[model samples]
Target: KKDIEYLSLKNLTVELSNLVFLLEQQKLKGLILDYVDLKDNGDYSMEYNMRLNLEYIHFANVEMNFFRWRDFFKFADFGKIILEFDRLLLQENVLSYIGLLNSYKNVLYLEIKFCNLYILRDFHKILNKFKYLQTLKLNRYNDDRNSSLYMFEAIKNMNYLENLTINLPYRGVYNNSDYFFGMQNFKVLCLTGTNLTQEIPNIKIWGNYTLLRTYIINKAIIKVYDLIEILKIESLTKLSFLDCDIEPCFNYISVELSGIKIKSLDFTATNLDVLKNFDIFKEFARLETLHLSNCNLKSGWLTQTNQSCNLSLKILHYAANCFDRNDLNRMNNLEVLEELNLRDCKFYSCGFFELGNDCKFLGSLKYLDLLHVEINIEDLIFLKSFKNLKNLNLTLSDADFFTAKNLLFYLPINALSLKECNKKSIFENSYSRYLYEENINLNLNSLSSKSFILIRI
Candidate 1:
């Protein structure tokens, strides 16, 4: 089967000419048809050396009449198409059946969820026929405010539109921060709104947006003077404040809005407990990724100020925040952190060698999630002092089975998930006699030796 290249077909009743002859005899390049029931076997002839290089096609809750697969997307030859569609039953009127996706006009990447573009008419003439669209996600676009500024003025002249996701938050849809001042050749602009707290239209028209890098603002309200003109745009470098609510007006400003070349700053579930002393991360000194997941952070919510004491943070998520030890020693100034998630946290009364002795970025961590942490085995033997821990998730941990076989016999872990662990002590028999010793190699789910240790239960 040429090692099947991604094909997910949920539910049944296929026959779209036997699902395009099973994606051309299993040469599939990704195809997920959930809740399928396609059936349109009239065999709309196309056999002259028939070719169909599909690059990804997802059709959720799919039934049929997707324009009767428009003659199998007009004699298939799709390449970079990443077309997704949820709640599919398009029958019609979705912008007059969105020109039946112009019969696959290269659709670079397009996601349309829960379809219902409210009162959106002439949606940019059906998105300018996806002129090789470069990523576009639209979900529940409850159009209003001039049909959402004519759908952001027809996707700002598309020109290979570089990522534009509009998930209409709260859905009252009145957005208008000048409907994204002409997108300036957007390089990722996610806007979900409620009020997006208008007003911004100055700051030299957002420094002409200079090919805006990445700017997301979901569940909006933002108004610290429109987040200082969106930190003066200056070619933004990734800035998200999902589930937002800023508005403190930077405490009646008095200077201090430093340089800011934003190097990723997603305040997920953003509330920041009311801008705890604000210090907008001392105005981003090229901050290296900081997501503050589910922010309900305690213990001085980071404020050792000396301008955030030289943060060289290289990824720190802080999932479901519930810290302690002075909030893990104030994230020991993100000592060159190299990825740390802390998923669904709850370590309040300190554990895991007190978070490996008060988080000094857990000794240059190399990816660690700790999903649903309620850890055990002496707090999973303090993750052997994270000597550059190479990927460890522990999905739903409680480590047993001899503490996950003593953490794969002393961690040098190169991927360990343990998803809902203890599946019959993970095939015990003394763990298949330590995987038949020798050079090691046990399957069912990873456990090769001399390195690659992905033991995901």
Candidate 2:
């Protein structure tokens, strides 16, 4: 009976381990362990046994008892492993404890955040010996000026690497030193919190494997010219700039074609006037989706200029701006446009009337978003003219004038989202009122329902 209980407990522990793995799987890659306390877990023997059984492991805020170092080292020799030690109170003695797992060559992804600088230096030296390493992400907790440079030098030594992401928390300029030297075959490179005031380092120096498809810059103070130089690379397809002050003519002025076949472009606080000229669009003829948020433009610039380019544009999103009805009318000419998203654009009264009359060419539109626009419910009623609209989003609008009977009249609409509206009392007042009075399903949720549906707040 005791043996049976032991086996049951073992199975329960395995199930718990799998559950923990599943919970962390979504946030981090592969596996993640955050702040596991080892001191109060009684004997250190079971922890070493668990590590031995775990083929893949990720640790964040984990505490280890130094007494089990030998057993843990032996168990780490099995398969893939990832160790993340963030905000650990190592008490100055953690370096020797960490040195035991230095020979783990099969670790595919490794991340170390917020450790003593000296301990990190030793960890860097240990990581250099890993032959099969693919990804290395390091975040320095200290504010030392030369810490990032030191980490860079350590990374340059590792030759057999594919992806590298680094976060430099210090306040200084990152120069081309020993750190940024040896990443010749790196397919993806991401740098955060570094003072990249000048142009991005020339990517041509990184050899021909140019697998850099995605690049993100957050709170960067670099100029538009600097960014244009980086875009000259032919391999980059996705680029995002957040809180960046890029010039309007960055794309127009840069004559060099990076050969970059950009598919999606996201610009926030960046001047898009660089794309005002039709020549830039010709270069990016393959662009499928364009996202422009918080950008300043002269209302009808995009609609007028985009007519000249041979764009296979399927989706165009412009939010949080002042666009006139004429701009919306001009977009109807884009015959291939499938999805149009215009949010927070304070429209003049009867703006929807203009769209209804002029935007007849947008017959192919499947999805339309007009959230927070100051329009009447009559505009939504007018949208019944569109024969192919599959999804409609009209959240936070003053469109409550349309009664349930009026909504049942529109038959072709598959999905309608009117969240947070001023019409919750109507649902209670009409149980079978819509069925008897209007002859349509009053509480319909399916897309196929041609009845009056209400998704109340």
Candidate 3:
């Protein structure tokens, strides 16, 4: 009880006053009550008039059928409030819920998920009532009526909102770009499954959002031209396109521009073939982090033409591709690369084990992920060239005890992962299990003499 700083109560029945008393006695910092039935016991309500100050309060999967919502807020003053209900039955009107939230003077962050907010008409207008909210995340289940259309119009005048996320799958939030005509600057804007293919009459209006830092689009339909225009925002740094269909607007012609200051660009699971006309590095000259995972890039994709360009990329994720040694060797311009992820890349019989000899990026790489890429004991010797490599992931590489021992003794990595698959062929063998345990013991003993290393099997 003395050591406990946070308490979690799930799928239980407890009086709100007793819960508060328990937290007060222990001086707990946070509380997570999931699927709990909270009751208002008037017996101790008057005795515990003192409000309990908490760092965070999370209520998830709780059915509000029998719980008194108004009574729950009076006992605690929370810094961050997260109310997630799978199915919420509001006994009172939605305004009462908003009033209860507005009464809380110290809530800085709030997240409400799957609360059927779309059922309430004009629900977005009441959002500005939470004047102290700095970060707000509202996720609604998709409805056929398109109720979320007026969602952005409601938060346009929110003066204190810096971070906002509106995730409503298959919902068109706005019809035109004029929805953000006079909006204040945001630090982060994350929208999933929203339509952003509207035409902008004037590009200068979007430049007003200079304070925007990170923009993330997941499974959204956005045009390539609109994306390029949005990248022109002055302070925007990180941009992610996850499972998004970015249609080419420039008639299959490569578009080039300068002065875009974005640092991180993620195109994970995106259809890169749409933008095959443009050279990504040449287009985003200041890009520091690039993720091109699962883009179906094969051999000869990074050819001599790529060698002529010098890249400023620090991290490169080339997972789930078909790049061989020749393709990797062409990336010699990645001298400043700090992290390289070649996970699930089919380097079979491609002499990738000797990649350290030709790849100039190995010296500067701090983290290397080779998960699911087969490596034998003979090729393991080449990994010694990674002098600055700190974290190495060799999960599912099927290394034996001797190979594992050699890695633990030779590599200067802080974390070495050698995760094995759960197949009966590997796990059922007693000899393999013996070797695995022996390898753990050897690695553990080496940690004492050498620098600290986290070995995970």
Candidate 4:
């Protein structure tokens, strides 16, 4: 009680009276009141003997409606407060919530999670009161289209807000000129979810509207105008179409933005026509990491991409698709690849065999996962060349196409991942059980020599 500076109550189901009694112990520097019972009394404004001296305070799953901030915080002073409450945490009385916000105008950092816009009657009012709020995190949950828009619309007067994280749901791709207002000075922005361009995309606006990086238009038909709009974002860098399906009506979706510095593009689980004709990487000169996993790149799409544009790529994760050795060989064009994940992929013809030239470009590769992949005996030998390899995950083929003893005999493999998928046969478990049956129990550490690459039958 004498030197207690930090106090955190998680999943608390006690009354405010009990919390008040705990507050009798002064000098609390930081307090996290998580899952506390703020609904114990109809009113929580009373005189207290002790003064709450706190710098950081976090309230989770608590309603501030009945809790009068003025009475409780007469002598209580805090700089940072995190309110992680949802619609359920609020009561019918919204004025008390506004009162609580008005009382804490001195806080520098404020984070409100799971904010339902429908219940945020005074959200704009509360925001206006916090003139000193430098950092704000508004994590909205399942609010309606209008409500979500209102929440964004309400974000004004935050002159000090430098960092903002808004992860509300929506359906579109937005440009800098489309929505974000009064937040032009923000340095750090994390839009963890979908942000539609205005409620409607057909609204004709005056020219010279500033276009941000890029926008992801969802559940909408792509037209010529849409394609043109995508190209307008001059500062486009990273693009992710998790499950968006874009029509391949156009024979070619040529992008000629030479200044488009896209470093990472994720088209995983996204269905599109031919990745070849699109030639979307023409202007993606600075593309570093690309994820086209499960993109249905059928057979020969990889070879068609502009090789010069992908030279800067360090991590190429394209797996769980049907492609052959001839197609995989095109990856050799990406001369500076550092990491490659070819797991759970189906090859029309063996994708990993005779890497005589297919494996030449992976000079900088540090991490490789060849789990449950199709390959032959020669492909296993192909791994020795990757000198920069650090982490390796090897899962032998379900079918014994490559019969080689001592499956993992590479030297200097820092970390190894071995997973057994075929439960019926343990003998084929990374060629481990076969050694067990042959009375040849080999310790991995005992037989790791680089100079001699041994393969026994």
Candidate 5:
């Protein structure tokens, strides 16, 4: 073994062959032949010797290009094995690999991502064989052309598995039926790119599984009511919905979630009217953080007649909405409001004026985003009233009156975005002047030329 280690052969095949021969010859204690592409050159004797030295081996990214099935079976009897067959055409070899893995009852962690295991018929049998398996991450690249139905059922039978992350293409038919059945020991369930529709599945069985802590349903069309109902289960504390369509009102929330006690909520790119009813907020008073990005509020007529009743709201985000000045003033009752995001809201002139005064009442506000809002010199002065303001964003150049220089002198912010501002020289001059006078350095980082400047204070 020492002779082979110090040999330093140039050809990888020769080097690996020599190492394998030496390992078997001396009966080595440990071996690591990772990423050494071994070809089947019609010589099965060398492969047999390599497998014989598999008492203690950790193979990683090992290309099994035309390797014998018998050789792999012998290699699978190791104390610990790490197999990586990335881009290997496992059409006829999957059954043999599964059979090999099933023999090893002591496998701890198995991660297979982007492999060509098209037909997973014996997947359940394979999963059942691993009695001591702790973690399993199976991510397959499937599309509309190849829709697999029994994949979920194969995964659901793994009773002893603790953590599971399944990333497959959208299969609405299969997801609606038999996806959430059996084996309820998952602490974290992450379903990515699954075509889950708006209709709620019969997940009454999940309520019995108290171990589930994190549930992430991304790129689906799940309704808000269904989500709230799912959260009604006491164990869930973290929930995230990405690119999902949610109703604007809580009228559809038939089930109550007030007692669920969720800590974190992410409703990114979902509808804003989901909070229209306010019953869910009034129920779940223990909410610490809430995200509502790309949530449109065109229908949320913020007249004195229609005010929001969600008093417990702390972090309010209205990214990519069409809220005016009145909308800002109406949310003054949110006394504990910590962060306010108005990114891409296309704010009019009056919107800035309203924010300057009305926002002062929010004593707990730390982050404020007015990105892409139309603001002038007066608006910058109005922003000074926010004593608790930690961050602020503004337009680089005021088309109406103010320049970057005038805006810089008004407030001492931490980060600034001056991208696409016609007066780049003005910003540099103002920042240099501020540094000379107050001994404080200031720089402007532009988000867009006409859009806004983000300043971290």
Candidate 6:
């Protein structure tokens, strides 16, 4: 079933004439209906050969009516509509789904979760009738006290929105961003405000969007000169300071994070734990993929490397911090670090990751996640000389079932993990004597002796 093109009908009571006989026998192109309780005035306008080759339609907690969803979107002949109208119950079926989206004028990606478009009375002129709406998400988790505050000014005629998400809490969004000025093709924006402030500073009136690129800070708490003036927008690359909150002065925004040209930086549970001078990762000369989960750096973050280190880092996640050994040698000078997650850190032993040698420090490490690190057994014995090591995770306290049975014999590990070990029959009798040693054909204890296996040859 993974040859999926997309078909979902959740919480079903499916019946609109067998749901238009399963969208004309599934000649589908993405259709999702959650909490479906179909049958409201069940009228399929003579199925039109079960009209539907839909180009994406997601309706959550659905309710059918507006001419039974305009006869299943006029039996969608597969073109127009990237609609994701979610979890609704708003009556007059959202003004008959905005008069069935004015006959689907090529609807381009519109998301309205937890719906209540202020009862659609010219709701932003009915979302500018999708004049090629690039992508727009609104009212997600719309704090319903019987939903009301809505004031969004119809995004001043979409004018080709590249991507805009407006989470309407206590709602008051009114965009005209100078009608998407300089037509820079806005890249991505998530505007959040309940009672506003922490500084949106009206996103500097969005004029010189200058090709804005990814800025999600949903659930506002923004500031620090309105997020360093929206990361100095010179075609910003990516900044997801998710679930918001910023004002933790990293050297007072280190001279506005030095001429920003952000290249993927997500900091969940933000504030960067009182940021101890990562000198703002030497001002992003193209920082590549850094998702800092649970930031807990006590001064000495990313420990060293400056003189504009041009860090094109390849994925590093310091999950559940307390990561020791100068935080894994401040990622051994990030030499193109290819994926690493020091899970549940703060190693007390196992030679503070001198791991008995061979990890010339993240030498282009091919994914390593040390879940719950309290290492031993010689830090999984020389960490099998990491160089492009495929995937590895350790748990059952990093060895001692006969030193994890020579851990797949001097590790030629394509992917290996030893989960939940507290001598559970010594890892199920050493994974049944390492799968009866079929001449030790290195299937490395075949994954699950209770989870953590990441098969990646």
Mind sharing the TM-score for model 1?
0.35
Query: Ranking under lDDT, best-scoring first?
Result: 3, 1, 6, 4, 5, 2
Residue by residue across 248-309, what tens digits does model 3's lDDT show? 67565345556777888888887766555666555566767878898777665655233322
Each candidate structure's TM-score, on Cα atoms with residue i matched to residue i, is 0.35, 0.66, 0.75, 0.64, 0.60, 0.34
Return the candidate ranking by TM-score, descending. Answer: 3, 2, 4, 5, 1, 6
Query: Mind giving the per-residue lDDT tens digits that candidate 4 earns over 328-392?
Result: 67776677888888777777755465556456565677888676565456766777777777766
- Alpha-carbon error at 381 in model 4, in Å? 1.9
Clashing pairs in 2: 33-60, 35-60, 35-61, 152-179, 153-179, 232-258, 233-258, 234-258, 234-259, 248-274
Candidate 5 per-residue lDDT over residues 1-457, each given as its tens digit: 3543222222255344655666667665455654555555566666656565344444445545445545655564554433445554543263456565445565666655545444355455665655565667656544242233445554555556777666543347445665454456777766666454533343455665578877776666655655666777688877777776664443544654446656667777765465555445445555556676675656233332212334455676667767665666666556667787777776543555666554535467677776566666676767777668776655544344335465556554544544445445555445446423444333335333443333343
Q: Candidate 3, residue 327: CA error in Å?
A: 3.1
Across residues 1-457, which tens digit of lDDT does each residue of candidate 2 receive? 2221101111112233343333334222233445445433445435534343344555555455566544555564434544544444562345456456546666666655556443444445555555466777655544344645555556666776677766643444244442453355676666555444533443344344367676666545554555656666567777777656554442345456635577766676566665555244445656667777667666765554345222366777777766776776666566666777777665543365466655644467788776656545566566776678776665422235334346634533332334333344446645335323343333544423222334322
Model 4: worst 10 consecutive residues (lDDT sum): 448-457
| Candidate 6 residue lDDT tens string, 1-457 | 3356778878878667777677667566787777677774444456574566678777666766566666566556444343445434543465455655563467777776544433444454556555567887765443432222222334545677688776533323223323333456778877665543434444464447777888777556665655556666777888887555565654444444566767688876576544443345666667778777776554346553342433576787867766456655555666666887877666532244463243344456787777556656656665666756666665544345455665545544443445554334444555535523433223435544554443333
Which should have the higher TM-score, number 5 or number 6? 5
Better of 3 and 6 by TM-score: 3
What does the lDDT come to for candidate 5? 0.56
Name every residue pair that clashes in candidate 4.
Answer: 173-215, 173-216, 176-212, 338-365
Which wins on TM-score, candidate 4 or candidate 5?
Answer: 4
Q: Supply the TM-score for candidate 5.
A: 0.60
Q: List the residue pairs that clash in candidate 1.
A: none
Q: lDDT: which is higher, 1 or 4?
A: 1
lDDT for predicted candidate 1 compared with the true structure = 0.63
Whichever of 1 and 6 has more TM-score, that candidate is 1
lDDT of 2: 0.53
